[model samples]
Target: MPAKTKEQKTAACMALAMKRGDLKKTPGTPAGDMAESMTEEQLVELCGSKVKKGG
Candidate 1:
């Protein structure tokens, strides 16, 4: 599912990174929780679009 908000996109990206071993996952945090619950493919689909520069 695509992210509906900037915060959601950011969280998905962070969670994806955690899943890929690029970032540390801290329990009880949003990104960490997402990392545990969602698959890497799911997180990627959520934030897969190229981010525009400077909003």
Candidate 2:
């Protein structure tokens, strides 16, 4: 899925942050939030678009 809004971005950010940390859970974080979930190809495309725009 694509992150089309700030809410989606925050959800994806939290999920990724949790994935990288050792904590089982984080307060105020939505455990069931998967609105921004995406496949590898989608991620690459999204980041690739940002990289181009940042240049």
Which candidate leads in lDDT? 1
* Every model's TM-score: 0.83, 0.41
- Model 2 agreement with the true structure over 1-55: per-residue lDDT tens digits: 3455555555555555455453354555552233234443543443333222221
Q: For each candidate in the order shown, give its overall lDDT on alpha carbons.
A: 0.85, 0.44
Best by TM-score: 1
TM-score of the candidate numbered 1? 0.83
List runs of model 2 lying over 4 Å from the truth. 22-55
Clashes of each: 0, 0
Runs off by more than 4 Å, candidate 1: 50-55
Model 1, span 1-55: residue lDDT tens:
5566788889889999999999988879989999999988899998786544453
Location of the lowest summed lDDT over 10 successive residues in candidate 1 = 46-55
The lDDT, on a scale of 0 to 1, for candidate 2 is 0.44
